[model samples]
Target: MRIAFYGSSLLSSYWNGAATYYRGLLSQLAKRGHQITFYEPDAFDRQQHRDIDPPDWCTVKVYPATDEGVRSVIAEAALADVVVKASGVGVYDDVLLLGLQEAARPGAIRMFCDVDAPATLAELRAHHDHPMHRVLPELDLVITYGGGPPVISAYEGFGAPLCVPIYNALDPETHHPVPPDDRFRADLSFLGNRLPDREARVDTFFLDAAARLPERSFLIGGNGWETKAMPANVRHIGHVYTRDHNAFNTSSMAVLNIARDSMASVGYSPATRVFEACGAGACLITDSWVGLEMFLKENEEVLVARDGVEVAEHIRTLTPERAREIGEAGRARILKEHTYERRGAELDRLLRNVAAAKRERSAA
Candidate 1:
């Protein structure tokens, strides 16, 4: 299958959280003998801070976010077997959505891949007249990163024929145990882009934890957090590159997973960092949310904390041997059940099934 994916930056993880998701899924899909082309805009600073060169498995084209640029890409995308217009492209999303829907035309499978389901669905629900609602009935398939019954039902209610949740998973080949980097060494760590929806949660789960455990060393990494006030015990590293994720994870005694407001409320969503940290053999402590048990067992594969106090206790009380045990257990679970290869296979099956069902309907 030849797949065309239009998404946020693929070569950089600068302000793009979906980069890891796209790279993992597409890389595995390519390994399975699929031809993939990724289309991303060149407007973001990602191009300036690019951590990697273009990957060999797939073609990545960075185009201007202009009318002419989109037209050229649309024509090329229309030729593929599947055309995916993913969420969080960071610019002209409405225009892109309409263009992709038009490009899909009579034959190509049209997909809306929502990297942020809670926010996407919430917008659709809050405003029935959202531009997306106008195109919802026409999309052949709808997919999301972190969603469950609530999100699926909402998308279906908005007129989607089929909506599926393809949660974040590990890509062990890219993210696994590595020797800890001295620069990132800390008792606790967190890495995430700063977004309005997530800052408050980060403050609660990460910053507050640092304050409560004043003696413990805390490290923060990612963009947009440089200006935030920090405790003397906390160290902030701006913009940790994708290449350094494993070392960043391994260097910390335990890493934190703080959910954004929308994702936290939605409940089933786990950020890509969660899997990456676990894959790197980091003991994981995550803020509380519903449906967490479905992904990782509480206190066995991961530790769940509801507030900064709980987070402090978890970090302070964990013995080194016990932490390593939990990290190993988490890694085992991810390798067995949640890898990009498994996700790619699941996607392949779903696409085939959808195509077969469509053919039958047409024949009838």
Candidate 2:
């Protein structure tokens, strides 16, 4: 199958957290002999700070941040067997959606992939005049990043003909354990862009934990965290590249997962970091969230912390032997059920089903 994806930056993990997710899924799909082309706009400073070059498996075309550039992309994308316009494509989301709807030819499967389903659903519910509500009926399918039942039901209720979830999973080839790098060595580490929805949780779970355990070395990696005042023990390493994720995780004794408010409320939505940490064979400590156990077993595979005190205790008291045991268990679980190949196979099945159903409808 030929697939075209219009998403946030695929070559840069700069401010775009979805880069890893896209790279994992699409690269896996390409490995399965599917032709994939990714179209990303040269906006949001992504091009300026790109951490990765063009991938070997798939073609990535970076377009100008102009109207004509988007129109050209839509025209090219409309010719594919499947075209996906993901949420949070920086400034051109509405324009791309409108153009995609106009340009898509008959029998072309057009999907709106919502990487930020919880926030998207919340906005659609709150604003009756939301543009997406007007465009929902035009889409062939709506796929999400695991908001579970609530997100699926809501999208369907809002006139999405079909809604499905393609959960985030680990890519072992990119994320597996490697020799630890001394530069990123930490007693506890957290790596994520400082988004508005996630800052509070980061403060409560990561920063406060650092404050409580002043003697323990804590590392924070990602852009937009340089200005924040951190504890003396905490080191802020701005914008760790995707290539260094394995080293970043391996160097840390334990890694922290702090979900955004929308994600935590929706449950069943594990951050990409969770899967990466597991793949890297790192002991994991995550803030409490609904349906977390669905991904990793609490206590046995991962430690759950309700507050800073719990995070501190987990870091301060967890023995090396116990940490290794938990890390190994988590890695095993991830390998068994949550790899990119698993997700790619699932997506292949789903797309085939959608195509078959479309054919049946056409024949009728």
Candidate 3:
């Protein structure tokens, strides 16, 4: 199968949280003999700050963030066996969504892949005339990286024929345990770009905890936080590239996972960082959310906290030996159950089923 995916960016993680998710799933799909062509617009200086060179697994088509640029790519993408318009492309999303549907050849499977399903669903519900409402019924399938049952149910309610959730998983080859680097050494570290929905939570879950535990060292690695207020114990390292993520995870005694407001409220949504940190054997402390038990065992594989106070308590009492125990357990669990190899196989089956169903319908 040849898949043409229109997404944010695959070569860069700068201000784009979906890069790792794209690389993990698509690379594995390619390994299974699927041909992939990733189309990403050059915007937000992402092309300037690329973390990885063009990958061998896929052909990356970098287009300008202009009307003509998008049209050219859309024409090229229409030739593929599958055409996918992923959410949050950051430029001309509406044009791409409708354009792909019109431009795709007959018998080609059309899919809308949502990396942040919770937020997307909220927008669709709030606005009845949203483009997705019009696009959903026409799409062959709606796939999400997060939001387990809620997202599936919501998309179906919005008239989608089929909706599926493919949760985030570790790409062991890309993200695994590495020797701790001195530059990232800290008691607790968090890596996430600053955004409106997530900033408040970051302050509450991360910054407040740092203030409470004055003696503990904390690290923040992401863009748009250079001016953000923080405690003296906290250090801000702007935009840690994907290459340094292993060191960032391994150097920390523990890492944190803070969900955006929508994801936390919707529940069952796990960020890509969850698996990455665990894959590197870093003990994780995450904010409370529903359906987490479906992924990692509480206390054994991961530690859960309801608020900043609980976060402080966890850091205060967590022993070095215990952190190692939890970290090792977490890594083992992810390696056994949640990896890109498993996700790619599942996706391959889904795509095959969708194609078969289309053929059956056409024959009927």
Candidate 4:
């Protein structure tokens, strides 16, 4: 199938958290003989900060952040077998959502691929007049990167015909163990764009932990944290590019995963960082959330903490040998069960089934 995906920037991970997720899944889908054309707006300085060139696996179409640009891309995207409007396009999202639905060719599979399902669902449910409510029934399918059952159930409640959760998985080729780098060396490090929904959690899980373990070194990498005050032990490195993600993960004794408020409340929504850090064989200490056991074994493959105190305790007690043991176990588990190849195959099967069913319906 020729899949046209409208998403956040794929070539840059600057402020776009979904870049790795898009690259991993779509690249694997392309390898399976599907042609993918990713449509991203050249907004948020992403075009200037591109970490990777247009990949051979998929074609990237970077359009201007204008109404004309949206129309032009939607018209072209309608030609594909599958037209997907992913969440958080960062510009004219409403126009893109409704426009793509109306513009898509008849019989073409129109999907809303939501990267942040928990938050999206919250908005839709809280506001009956939400634009997504208007678009949901028109969509052929709803797919999410994470949010296991709660998200599926919520989307179905909104009268969606079908809702599927394709959890985040590791792209081993892109994120694997590398030699540690001096710049990133720390006892515990976290890499995520500072966002409103997640800042409080970061304060609790990362910053507070750093304050508690003042003697130990800590690292913070990602954008939008330049002004946020932190302990003297914490080093703020703004926006670690995708190229250095492996080193950022490998150099740290432990990496932290802090879910945004909505994701943590909804449970089961694992950020892309989880897979990337674990893929690099980093001992991961993530905040407690439901449905995590389905992805990685607690204590053995990952260390779970409920609060900053727990996070501090984990860092204080975790020996280098033990961290290595957990990291290796996490990496091994991810390679066996959560690689993008596995995710791509599963997605291919689902897409084929959905397309076949649509064909049967049309015939009927």
Q: How do all models score by TM-score?
A: 0.98, 0.97, 0.99, 0.99
Q: Kindly report which residue stretches of model 4 are placed more than 4 angstroms away from their true locations once superposed.
A: none
> Which regions of candidate 1 are displaced past 4 Å?
none
lDDT of 1 by residue, 1-364 (tens): 7899999888998899998999888888898888999999987777998878999999999998888987888778768988899998987788889888887757778889999999998888789778999898988899899878889998999999999988899999899999989999999999988899989888888989999999999999989887899999999999999889999999989999999999999888988998999999899999999899877888999999998889999998998898899999999988888898998888888887877877787889
What CA RMSD would candidate 3 show?
0.7
Residues 1-364, candidate 4: write the lDDT tens digits: 9999999988999899999999998988998999999999989999999999999989999999998998899889668999999999899899999888888889999899899998898888789998899888888899899888888999999989999988899999899999999999999999999999999999999999999998999999999999998999999999899999999999989999999998999888888999999999999999999999999999999999999999999999999999999999999999999989999998999899999999999999
The 10 consecutive residues of candidate 2 with the worst lDDT sum are 97-106
Query: Candidate 2: where are CA atoms >4 Å away?
Result: none
Candidate 3 lDDT over 1-364, as tens digits, reads 9999999999999999999999999998998999999999999999999999999989999999999999999998668999999999999999999999999988999999999998898899899988889989999999899898888999999999999998899999988999999999999999999999999999999999999999999999999998898999999989999999999999989999999999999898889999999999999999999999988999999999988999999999999899999999999999999998999999999999999999999999
Ten-residue stretch with the least lDDT total in model 1: 100-109
Q: Order of all candidates by lDDT, from best down to worst? A: 3, 4, 2, 1
TM-score of 2: 0.97
- Looking at candidate 3, what is the lDDT of residue 253? 90
lDDT of each: 0.90, 0.90, 0.94, 0.93
Clashing pairs in 4: none
Steric overlap count per candidate: 0, 0, 0, 0
Candidate number with the higher lDDT (2 or 3): 3
